[model samples]
Target: VKSQHSERCIDFLTKELKVSNEKQAQERVLFVSARETLQAR
Candidate 1:
């Protein structure tokens, strides 16, 4: 990533897409949190 891509690309892709090897883990966390938030309301 450091050698091939620019910093901007990394930042946008990471934050917007939440991409990487841990994508599944991150997605699960996001869904869990959303479910909790909805339940709270």
Candidate 2:
């Protein structure tokens, strides 16, 4: 069973955040993760 907000972050990114398609969606996650990784050093 999926929660009410299941995959909601993806929705926000694609809708309100205007991320467009899957490639753009994945890229956004990767970029943010990389930024966090660098900051943790």
Candidate 3:
């Protein structure tokens, strides 16, 4: 289910965040995940 969640996240990022390219989408994911991790602490 984790893979599905990843796809969903990517889809949401692409549609809502308006990330145009694969590389930017990936970077945005990494950045968002990192920020979430920090916020969890």
Q: Considering every candidate listed, which one attains the maximal TM-score? A: 3
- What TM-score do all the candidates reach, one by one? 0.31, 0.34, 0.44
TM-score comparison, 1 vs 3, better candidate = 3
Provide the lowest-lDDT 10-residue window in model 1.
23-32
Ranking by lDDT: 3, 2, 1
* Clash totals in order: 0, 0, 0
Instruction: Write down the lDDT that model 1 would get.
Output: 0.49
Rank candidates, TM-score, best first. 3, 2, 1
| Residue range 1-41, candidate 3, lDDT tens digits | 55666677787878877755556765665424566779999
**TM-score, predicted candidate 1 vs. hidden true structure:** 0.31
Encode model 1's per-residue lDDT on 1-36: one tens digit a residue. 332334445554567777753454334342125566
Residue lDDT tens for model 2, 1-41 = 13323356557778887857656755554323556679999
Candidate 2: which stretches are off by over 4 Å? Answer: 1-6, 23-41
Q: What is the lDDT of residue 24 in candidate 3?
A: 71
Residue 12's lDDT within candidate 1 is 49
